[model samples]
Target: MMPSPYPLEKDLGMRYYASDSPGIGGRLRSSPEDFVVEELPLPISDPNGPYLICRLTKKNWELQQAVKEIAKHLGISHRRIAWAGTKDKNAVTTQFISIYDVTPEAVGLVRIKDILLEVVGRSQHPLSLGDLAGNRFDIVIRDCNPEELAKRVQAATEAVSAGVPNYYGLQRFGVVRPVTHIVGEEILKGNYEGAVVTYIGRTYPLETETAQRARRNFAETRDARAALADLPIQMTYERAMANHLVANPGDYAGALRVLPPKLLSLLVSAFQSYLFNCALSSRIDAGFSLTEPEVGDRLLFANGREDIVSSRNRQAALMQIRRGRCRIALFIPGSEPMASHGPMDEIMQDLMEKSGITAEDFERASRFVETKFAGTLRAISLSADVQADISGESVRLRFTLPPGHYATTVCREFMKADPYVMI
Candidate 1:
């Protein structure tokens, strides 16, 4: 029988390459102003293209809602709008979005509460994922003792210089419900119907009382009809799936189809991230340094393949590290091509077997519905331009990280507190 899945929470099972330090207890995201992010878009040539790019700054707005609003005002489908990346829902963020043939007059007409949009320029090519060099962050951590905070900061600085493990931020998985991966695991097991149940009926102990009751009732009775009333009306995806199940009864696969393709893709991707986290943690436990590259480890910026010819492979991989040209990384299993050598390979394979998967599942899982995945590289450590300042009861941190790396992971190295407690 399979072991019970690990609980998803802030910092649960995450590995820390930096040595632990005493944390100065503080609260993050005390307000939207406390966290700020701006995209560092890739360099562009002349703005002589068919695509209209806008620099949008949003405060306390979710990306999906903001996209839908822009689409409505522009008289186009949501799919017509494209962005380099998604920003935090509860953060102050600015990023570029490219829409084909959009007029400034139409952009001015967009009115999402707390969202501000501006037409930056025109581009021939739409900004796709990983188009940014990184993100710049300005953050404030409040209510920490000055003395302890300084020590923590000093420790964090050393860790930063040495490189901290680039673990996924707590926000990678939902903070409140943390069920994206749970639903994904069921999907991987070929239980389409079970995925719906897990989404609607699974409850965590830390969840709100109302949510707990709703999920517990559904889990016990397995009745979509009853759960619909119990689930908050704001849960449109859950409500849609439940409504379908209530009417169609056992059409599990159809129920899974209720979510939009982008959202559906996110669920599967989140699961892959979860496994990546586990694999990285395993490698750390076996004594890999976040700062150094080893013979068997794949690099973030290196082109990887199934056949890793041995002769110059180790020398080439290590050369990138020596020049700090590559970020350390682990592969998220799925139709993605990957190669691991030495102890790390054994560790990853062990994790696969424990999860009821063979080494082949890495490539086999790409066929699942809405589960589009390809082998990709992600850095396990990052290089950042960080600055810290102290003012009264708060510590202000400013930095820029490479694309796909999270600022929260950097903060975790210093705080060393339960993600909930620190943030």
Candidate 2:
């Protein structure tokens, strides 16, 4: 029999830490100074193939909402604009956005205040999807102790230098696992629309033992008929089993020879989910999120409460540093001039001690974090910035990471010092 969907230990064997701390619970703490909202002018180069580059305060706005605002201002559908990646709604973010089929003259006619839309350097080639390498960020961290703060900064620098593990951020599970449960149920029901919607919404839950076993069986047998026949009631089981077969080369060949078209499709989806989760976990371990600061990339960060931003901003930056608060931010390449170095393990250990996380709990959490980093995607470049006066007691941090990395894995290290809110 497969393991239970809910693990008794509550660790769930997933690398990303889901904290039991009170209030909004997750890997990241709430900060008032998380984001610096601004609308900067876009630089223009090509007037013919008119593309306007806009920078967003990633910490304050949702990627989807930002896109919508741009689309509306440009008199085009949301489909017309393109971006490199999504930015976190809680921290400051900057990136470029492009408007197609519109001339510079036409673009000049548009007006919007919330977005700092201006024409930056334009290209003859229309800004297609995935046109950016990465994003650059300027984050501020406040209210921290000189000694502890120095130690934390040194540790962060070291971790970045050594290359942090890539894991999926907690956002992938959709705000306390709601999306995951929704997708799991939808998959079980064979509701394609529901599954797709939830997946797009970033609501899919972490893989469970039953799901894993089903996937493994599906891959091994490549016999959808048998799987369906055997597990008719548990569609998730059948799908998982088929997907496992598709991912393994040996299973793929077996399934190709034995499974029918319907089963094949199910297998394909299963394979896709496995691959995606792998990427997601890898990115998280590396301290990154799926949303890029680029164009044409659809990413979402849940900014449930507007007050959180203000609260973080109201505190003294120095006090936050003294408190050893944990801050979360996104970083992009070349956006800022700061240097980055090393993984955050040592800092995590220190903060864990301060936060009162027992050595045993830390060990358990470390295991899950390790599992997430063992996958295919390896860590790439790293960048750093700080958030000050966050939540009147803590500091916020931003790191520029590669695609498919999570920021929470690093956040878990600071859980000892910084309490978080999961909205």
Cα-based RMSD of the predictions, in order?
4.0, 17.2
Measured with C-alpha atoms, the lDDT of residue 128 in candidate 2 is 37
- Error of model 1, residue 104, in angstroms: 2.8
Residue runs of model 1 more than 4 Å from their true location after superposition: 1-12, 44-50, 301-320, 336-340, 358-371, 421-423
Q: Which stretches of candidate 2 lie over 4 Å from their true place?
A: 1-33, 36-47, 50-52, 56-59, 109-113, 126-129, 140-153, 172-190, 193-393, 396-399, 403-409, 415-423
What would the per-residue lDDT of candidate 1 be over residues 1-423, giving only the tens digit for each residue?
011122343233465536566655577888999999999887664488878888989998778778877788778988778888878877899998888777878888888778889888888888776777779999888887667667778777776766776677777676666778767777766678788888888886677788889888887888899988888877777888989999999887788877766667677677777777777776676777665667666665544333221446767766667677666666566665445665656676676667775434434445656455765556667556578887887888898887788888777665555566433
The lDDT, on a scale of 0 to 1, for candidate 1 is 0.72
Clashing pairs in 1: 328-380, 334-362, 336-375
Question: How many residue pairs clash in each candidate at the backbone level?
Answer: 3, 111
Candidate 2: tens digits of C-alpha lDDT, residues 108-186:
6666544455556565554432355544333344444444454554455444433332333344443334344334334
